[model samples]
Target: MTKSISYRFALCICVLFSVANLSVADTLTVTWTGAIGELETTIMADTSADGTQAHAVYKLESNKTYLQRSTIVLESSCDIVGAAYGTGETPATIQPIPGDDGASQFAGWPAGNIKTYGEDQSYAFKNLLFNGVFADGSTTLFGVLATYGKGNTITVDHVTSVHNQVITYFCFGQEENWTLTNNTAVQYSCYPAGMYFGGFWWGGGGGWTGTVESLLIQNNTIEGAHGQAFVIYDNGLVNRTEGEVINVDHNTFVNIIDWPKFYRHGNNTRWTNNLFVNMAANGQTRNAANTNIALNNDHVGGHGKTATLYQGACTDSTLLADGNCWDRTNRNISYQNNAWMDTPELLDMFAMEPWCWDLPADSNGVVVTLCDTMIANQSKWAGDSTMSMFANGVYMSNNLHMSDRGWNLDPVYITAQTTRTRDWLDNGVHDTHTDHFWMHQADGDKITVEWPLPMDFSYLATSAAATHCTHGGPVGSTHHMDHPAGLTLNTNPDGIVASTFALKQNYPNPFNPSTEISFNLDEIADINLSIFNMLGQKVRTLTNGTKPAGVHTLEWDGRDEMGQRVSTGIYLYTLSNGSKTITKKMALMK
Candidate 1:
């Protein structure tokens, strides 16, 4: 409890309160004496230009550091928290100010250390410690920028960022909710020289389209070099507006350099129960120019070698007739129960050889026939199977590929070596190819986890391979590491209750005008709930009645049963109570 006794207990509660009868949700602690701009002059003197005193709550004082010479322009609805000086003190940092180079002191293109502005605001950055470097260190492009707004509600809970090229950007909103929970991002610098690092960079780019009604990247932990641990850009003319969601759940992601890049377009994307480790670890130097390439080169291991857990793309055929493309027959993307591992030294550095390219000898040594016809048209366009892109209305279940070096990480033979497939793992009506378990066919042992990762990046809860890869029971990222313990210092993290009889999965799931479907009952049940489509029929019927005994939420507005609206793709809801039934799937992207 240092920092001069937490700044003399926040100056003894501001000399026993009475700063003109504090209100607007009180709290204004700000005690960083070594100030430069003094936290934007105490948040512009508790902002209130018409945001009705902007619900102030600056706080920050724990192990003090705040300097920040420029950006901090939040303009309204506030709550910056971070004062609890107890369990291991620290946290209260906010860097930049010594030779400040916050991305060249902002002139354009993402430059923030806290930048939000107007519109429907709500911002909150709890237990702060964003040290994106500066104060004589370097890097720092953004830590909380909230790219212009429209219904904002941002919330970077338990914040921690380190190098930060982008740790929380949020963009072009229309409904916006973005909540990066239990945050920790540690992006190893590659800075603004050629962008891309992100540990939470949301959608809608330049031309700024809209819609983002919710993007909760849960239980965050993201680590190293991260060329993507949730970039999800959009703006090909934006789609999914009926409830729009992008929930990358239960995150943990370690040596990241891939997986979660989903640029160009998206819709109801849900990569659930996440915990990928060493994914593409700088796949041959991320923005590659052959930085010593050779991890068994064939461009180092099969299928897009690392960045494909649905890295959506679209080369504008007028934005694919405006459905804005990521079109898994209209993006209802879902990769469930995720838990990948990798590190048989990164799966033998992505093993899969054969295709030794050295080509270039033209001075009569005879190799260059235009470099062997551009290497056989790039290996026949990388082993084309009709240049694949299979997986429609995508959904893969019980995911759990592993390899703490026990081999076999086979994402369906690495997505059949290219273009994209999970063709429902060979279509026997969805998941088959032995329904996901690879680490040499499971059965136990090898699941150790501990290489610069354990400050709650947990995995060894008596691992029988993490209890045979459970999801819904334990999967990955169960949060807690940066300032955990009852989250004091203006407490925040809590809400998550619901034990037993579940049924979730349906919040903006490719939705377009409405969607919400929670469940959980463990008691007074008589439920039915309905919805069906994809030929199983039953178009709508939301709830046949009697529910009680706990959590229930229900919404669906993309109507039917006479209310109209229904067309799009994949549906199926079904909850039931007659001896318990459950069904799931959703997607309605109009």
Candidate 2:
């Protein structure tokens, strides 16, 4: 009996030790450290029915890519909350710190703060790069919250999400409805909107009437988004009991189609200190109660100043747009203390006065160089590879080489050294890296066209003797061409390949009898080059067969499919392979 009791006591001690070890093991930790790409993490509650804590950390080295198609997903029914950590506001100020590239730089949410509230969480991402995304692609790359509980807080700060074509970074309200006042989104990169607040249309759900309160969006740089920076709409549903109090401030937006627009919203929607450049259309359209729009500044780039303010039909009288710096007029809305400082063309286009008829008139507003306001720092003027700086001039370098120090239309290549330039003596040949030429629209037209230089003639041919000349055939030859690798025919002994596919503007555009339509193919493919009249009727078929890729030219004799010359008018020439198609317009002066 004594021996048996001793054995039982020993077994009890072993059981207790195992239980203690299991308790400590319940704490979960997930970590990912590597180059930029897709990442995922899943955490579940301990099986003991006791709420255990789980922690996750992600670290990236550096990335210069965009539209990465990377994803960080966190799916759980347990408690999940997170805070972004790092500082990456100015690239020059920060010396590209090792181990952290993207997580810390943005325009929104306070820098370093951690507050947790949320039940059954999804993902939190930081320090990443993306190339581009599409609408039909995996829309949810980050997180999809399936359940909602009270006092649940989700925080996303100090994260840079850039160059997504259409997919939103984060999505809420899919399976069950939940109210969240502790959720925060800030400091993102280029997304359709920094954040989208609505129900998933394809998820077979009705509208989301969940309350999202005290959400803060600030201090992020966004550009190249095709839709509004932020949108909260439920199929235009009226009074369905969804509440939201959003604060959008201190963000930089460029090349945006629309600003933050709210069709169905709650109270206390405020937008301030947000800088918008190269806006394609309207700024803000908030038709909500207690809506305060103030101190928002904007500039329309080369695209026309069609930005509008259409609050004229708001039923809520509390909607006030005051102390903003946009094109404000009484044409469609009631506004005050707003200012307008557009170009003479914009001034004539709008035909509205500078000052709005509201209290605290906009006396401090004035027009300045649009580029100056964009760079934020004058020292970062030319060398900054991140943002494009627009200019209009031609200057000579220290070597007496003429250079076009003006806008390079391609935003992807912004560094001063990489920008395209034309030397005065090059006969029309441009540098290898340059994509556009700074030229007057016409012989006397002062406005520069930044016309895309011909790919075949654009690059400089450098021989071993350091002699530089145009790469293509004799300067005036129409077939000066380079074939993309697979597009070249086996007959060419030199085995040269084309690097890019392009359709050049037809030369001698107003030719009476015939004109040359030129294009370069990068790869061999079945092609269909056809001409269509302004009325969308196929007037002539240029080529509809397999063609070896190189720079090829076809003579359109200004004739129709019936082999008869058509009347003088405008026509569109379309170039289509099996996968891609492009169109260009031309005029025939018969």
TM-score for all models, in order of appearance: 0.28, 0.32
Tens digits of per-residue lDDT, candidate 1, 450-510, equal 1222233555544323433222244455553232223221112222222345565555333
lDDT of 2 by residue, 26-111 (tens): 21323334322222223332223334223323233332221222222233222222223234421100011111333422112211
Local accuracy by lDDT, each model:
0.51, 0.31
Candidate 1, residue 24: CA error in Å? 5.5
Clashes of each: 4, 29
The candidate that achieves the highest lDDT relative to the unseen native structure = 1
- TM-score result, candidate 2: 0.32
- Poorest 10 consecutive residues by lDDT, candidate 1: 1-10
C-alpha lDDT of candidate 2 relative to the true structure:
0.31
**Which runs in model 2 stand beyond 4 Å of their true positions?**
1-38, 41-53, 56-73, 76-151, 174-210, 234-245, 263-267, 282-590
Which RMSD values do the candidates have, in order? 24.1, 30.6
